[model samples]
Target: MSKRATIHRMVTPDHLCPWGVKAKDLLRRSGYRVDDRHLKTKEANEAYKRENGVDETPQIFIEGRHVGGYDALREHLGKGPDPKEGKTYQPIVAVFAVTGAMAVTTMLSTSTSATIADGWAWIRVGELCVAFSMCVLGILKLQNLQSYANGFVQYDLVARHWVPYAYVYAFVEAGGGVLMIADIATLVVAPVVLVISAIGAVSIVRAAYIERRDLNCACVGGGSDVPLGFVSLSENLIMIAMAVWMLGKGSV
Candidate 1:
């Protein structure tokens, strides 16, 4: 018999609670038979919270013992807290994974005879992935632009001296990505992208390698705990490579 657990989480038309989803997934992964309860309305959800004397939803119960919220459930299951001090690659990995899929799908949609055998197709995929990754990353940063600017200035040599640069960097990156994707103004966009990416690469090298300082990367987002190192450096280098390729190819 499996360990039985019950979870009451919010699920309304407009809002599906992410923590609730995470809690349920975690329970399933931990070998628990979960009785997932949905509080389908705002009023009902509030009432349940009030009756249970809990401040939030996604409350868990195991063997009739209250396990509290998601964090509490993690503790109850003997899983320690997520490492805040330690670096993580999960966010960056997820970003690239989505970008890669999008790149391939884009190729397929644009070309009737799209195949991996075509070297140009592969090059286009590479370019698309790099551009899309930049756009995605920029969007992430722009979600909390002020926070991103603060975090970015810590290591970016240009941002350190010119604080305003950090704030506008996301726009620049995303705009470049858009231009590259549209194959518009390649002569203008490619050189600009190359310069920014090269500067970013240099900044990462100076901060991570030369200084030997441990810092969180603002490449994905300001709130992310991703480390400042190879992954971040590679993001810039890949963008640089794409920009150089575009410049050489003279647009499409």
Candidate 2:
């Protein structure tokens, strides 16, 4: 006979506990027949928690032996909780990969007709990559401007002082990216991005390096969980470099 597992989870009209669902799925996949018990109301949930002497919901019992919550259940089943489930660089990696591919394609397509030196052509590709990446990131931020503002204020110096800067910042990035893509308005767009990115780089240095405070970066967007550190700093630095490169080329 298969072992029986019981899960006491909260399922209100407004919310269905996600961990509860995950636990049930895990138990079933592990060959255990689960008795899914829903605490439908807040009072019922509180009462069940009192009875079980537990502060949280989604309590699990395996074969009438108390096994605790989701994390405990995973440990009991000999599978540790996935380390990469929460904090991940997958989103940033995807953005970079797509932009890089676009840059390479654009470069290859124009390589034969290129009037510039080979080295300058490669630099142009790098500019395209940065511009595209910035556009994508800016779009993500603008999708949830309020959310991004909330996250941005945590570490951004300009955002902390002037709340509206976060929203403007998104537009600036997108605008600069668009101009860069068309290879137009380098005199204006390059300097604008350079100043913003320089300010951002300094802010990052102060927050992540000097202060040593751990926080989520709003680089990718408000919902992203990418850590506020080297990756974010590098992003700002790349923008700075691209802006400088464009300005230098324009001068020649």
Candidate 3:
């Protein structure tokens, strides 16, 4: 026979405790025959809490032994706490994935044969990938411009010196990306992107690698919690490389 679990959850008229629902679901999924007890009133809930000597609801008991709350129950079930409970790379992943897809689509559309053998074709694909990634990142930053600007001052050299630059940085990146995609104004955009990205790269390296400051990266936007590290540096380097490549090609 499976072990029995009792979950005491609070469900008032106006409120249904989310943690309680999670506890009940976890217990059921863990092969426990759950006896779900709903405390539907404040008095009843308080009485239960007082009786159990626990300050919170959504208390769990497995085989008549107290298993505490959701986190405690997870431990009791032999599963450790989630490592990535707070931090996430979802925004960065989304940006890169979309950029890669767009690059591939552009390559396929422009290619003459099944395989992309032309060197120039590959360069165009690379440019598209970098440009698209920049556009996406810029759009994310522009979504919450104030937050992005606040975060930017922490590491960006220009933004630290000139506050207005932080506000305009996202627009610059997006504009450059659009021009790159359209294959227009390479003489202007490439040099501008190259200089800005080089400065950003230097700033990131100083803050993250040299100074060893543990901070959040604003690369994916101010809303993201991505760490300030190699990934951010890599982003700037990619833009620099793209700009250099475009400039070199334009000269030829």
Q: Which candidate is the best by lDDT?
A: 2
TM-scores vs. true structure, each candidate: 0.71, 0.77, 0.83
What is the C-alpha lDDT profile of model 3 across 37-120, one tens digit per residue? 889998999999899789998899888988898889888888787355455666677789889899989899878884588787
Q: Candidates' lDDT values, in order?
A: 0.90, 0.91, 0.87
Which ranges of candidate 1 are over 4 A from the true structure?
1-86, 114-116
* Tens-digit lDDT track of model 1 for 39-146: 999999999999979999899998778999998998888998745556789999999999999999999887767465689887889889988988999899889998
By TM-score, the best candidate is: 3
Query: In candidate 2, residue 3 scores what lDDT?
Result: 90
Global fold similarity of model 2 (TM-score):
0.77
Worst 10 residues of 3 by lDDT: 82-91
Clashing pairs in 2: none
Count residue pairs with overlapping backbones in model 3.
0
1-252 in candidate 2: lDDT tens per residue?
999999999999988999999999999999999999999998999999998799998999999999999989999999998465577777888999999999989888878755445787887788899999999999999899988889999899998999999888999998899998987999999999999999899999999999999888898888788888898999999999999988998888
- Model 3 ranges off by over 4 Å: 10-18, 38-51, 84-90, 109-112, 115-120
